[model samples]
Target: MDGNKALIAYETKGGATEEAAQKIAEILRSKYQLEVDLVDLKEQKMPDLSQYRNLVIGGGVRAGRVYDKVLKFLENDLSGKRVAFFVSSAQAGTPGSYEKAKIKFVENTLAKYPKINPVATEAFGGRIKILGKTVTDNRDMVKVEAWAEELGKKFTQ
Candidate 1:
């Protein structure tokens, strides 16, 4: 839809997921001329879904599940909207456990979305820095970027 509004909400542990969110927002903006709202989940309110026709959420996956805010957003009434989710984690591999984890998250959400369904969903690999104050662990920018690009396409679609 022309002139449709898109919102991308994100929760970042060390900034990687925030980057992914921005990347997806950029993709949506560049290709569709849509207004994109990038919200930091930590500080923002619960979000009113009635304002926008399209929405995207990205957050860091720690331990297993992603940030709590993103999770809450998922439970909202999405109904007939176009929506997607992207996550950043240390488990990214060339079809390894991390990929499995993301896929599972996607599948489960999709299956459940019929109850509160969106138009689509996506998951992107995230990074962690092994030695930094604000970030540490395993940093995989390449993997994250690849997913971000793909996610961009998905959002546009």
Candidate 2:
């Protein structure tokens, strides 16, 4: 268990975060031929950080913060690691109230892990709308998958 592997974990409330995680995993796999593992915060217990060399985390932005599980998981043992984080927010391009909230979420999360050398950390745009048995305005997982592939390029440099 050397610290050279890549791990991607996520907590998605309405499946958006999971979609982003899958995209990131595919990107790393297809571009760099890297073996990335996806850990669902809800389904699995937290894994030891020392077991991997690289780590990526993503979760849903709810109310004004990352999902509770993601917050708790990354709070511990994030020092001296190559890490990246992302949140799936309902707000994509507009710097509105939700956007600021997302930024705060990132800020607070990063505050806990000051030593993380993240090459990239940003919120994936769009959201999951659930209202009375209807849905609208979901971000495309395909794009995230492609972006994840592109983001992997960061590791090469």
Candidate 3:
């Protein structure tokens, strides 16, 4: 594995998760000087994991469930890699339900995968649109960037 390389793999429905992945990739590359690769899970079901030492996986929540693609990806053997996980959900964005959303979508979900111990995990706000018009948008790019910065430090260590 290349210690200097990182992979930001994500699956999105309304684009919030993809945006978060991009922001994370930007911070890891520009601030940490880490070589980062962004992959959309929808396009690539399986990416060659042998080349990266750090892996960041992200997904979106819909109908109260994390994206299936991400869950499926998690089934892969991730041993010896610095893994991080994140999810984008409307509940996560709302101040009242953020903790619950984190528990349900991040904590509880990861609990099922006992073999994959992530170095960091987070739940970010999501956007909902109708007819090409945004109806609800709670995404915070600043928060995403901050998380990325922290992840960069961890990845390097």
Candidate 4:
């Protein structure tokens, strides 16, 4: 509650965003020994930011749109906090589309919240669904772990 604690708040469409949040929490807890909380944007309200030392916020993208709740959270006062933002989308994991996805996410989300300067930001590949059928999953654990690890290091520094 006081030190080495982080909150990972996220919104999901088909659970990809939630999965990414959980993976980040797991990596932080296991590798960095940090206490991480995974919050579902739809099910729970935002906790007091003053309680945590760091924050990680993410959302899933659908049809080039991000969840409104994720954007709202970014509107908060995040100065003097270590923060990171990420997005999960089908295009994010594609070979040539990842850069575009990152640009789109930053332009749409991060650009709107210029006050919230994240130490690290990324766009991860998410699962694709067609008519409720799983088409593709591009979530990479290696990437997730590395990002999470870097987040921990930022806090320690």
Candidate 5:
């Protein structure tokens, strides 16, 4: 609700996207001294976009696409906002699949919202498990924190 505040709205099917959102929020709050609000998209309550100076929307990759709630949230008016986009996917950590993941998750979202120019767009590593067996565990806290720090610089400047 303050100009120095940031809102990180995320859509998560599992918990990887939520983990990324929390990491971003922690970085912004501790390192950048910004008040942050972490909102789950399924909560059904959207914050007033004009209230915060920074907005970060992210979600996990499902079937090679971002969550529908995330897409719907982006459909709102985002003019005059310092926005950032991030996505969590196992493909993000795979050398051969990283670019494709970025295209599918980040670039495609940009294509949909041509009017909104994000300050930063990132594709972070994510974890996935089936039947309690790890399929991939690529979630990297360092990368996520660095991206959030970059976002802090963008918002502050």
Candidate 6:
């Protein structure tokens, strides 16, 4: 693994996951001085993972489950990589339900894949729309940026 290379791969339904992935990639590149590659798992084939020292995977949640693409991606052998995971969910954005959402969406989900030991993980708020009208906008970019900053430090360390 190249110590300075990182990959941010994600799947998004309502665009929240992709937005978070972009923010993370930006921070890793600009602040950490890392070579970052952003991949939309829905649109592109998975790149060769051997080139990256840090791997950040994320997806949006709906109906109490993380996106299928991200789950499938997690099936890869991610040993010896600095892995980080995140999810975007409406429940996570709610103050009262944040912990439950993290457990169900991030912790419990990652538990199924024993080989993946993430250096960091988080659950961010999501957005919901109905017929092109915004209904719930719970995304917090500041929180996302803060997580990325911490993740950058972990990756470099």
TM-score: which candidate is best? 6
Model 5 alpha-carbon drift over 4 Å, by segment: none
- Using all chains and alpha carbons, the TM-scores for the candidates as numbered come to 0.75, 0.80, 0.98, 0.93, 0.94, 0.98
**12-86 per-residue lDDT for model 5 (tens digits):** 977898988998898888888888989999985887778888899998887878899999989888888899999
Model 1 C-alpha lDDT versus the unseen true structure: 0.66
lDDT of 6 by residue, 39-127 (tens): 99999988899998899999999999999999999999999999999999999999999999999999999999999989999999999
**Stretches of model 3 off by over 4 angstroms after superposition:** none
lDDT of each: 0.66, 0.72, 0.95, 0.86, 0.88, 0.95
Error of 4 at 10 (Å): 0.3
Deviation in Å, model 2, residue 20 alpha carbon: 0.7
Rate residue 156 of model 6 by lDDT: 91
Candidate 2, residues 44-82, lDDT tens digits: the string is 876777777677888887676778888887776766566
Greater-lDDT candidate between 2 and 6: 6
Worst 10 residues of 4 by lDDT: 105-114
Per-residue CA lDDT of model 3 for 1-157, tens digit only, reads: 9989999989999999999999999999999999998989899656689999999999999998999989988998889999999999999999999999999999999999999999999999999999989999999999999999999999988
40-121, model 1: which lDDT tens digit per residue?
9898775566877777777777777777777776777776666766666666432457658666665554565456554445
Measured with C-alpha atoms, the lDDT of residue 20 in candidate 4 is: 77
Q: What lDDT does model 2 reach?
A: 0.72
Superior by TM-score: candidate 4 or candidate 6: 6
Model 4 lDDT tens row, 66-124: 88889888888888888899999889899999888999975567887878778899898
Error of 3 at 32 (Å): 0.8
Ranking by lDDT: 6, 3, 5, 4, 2, 1
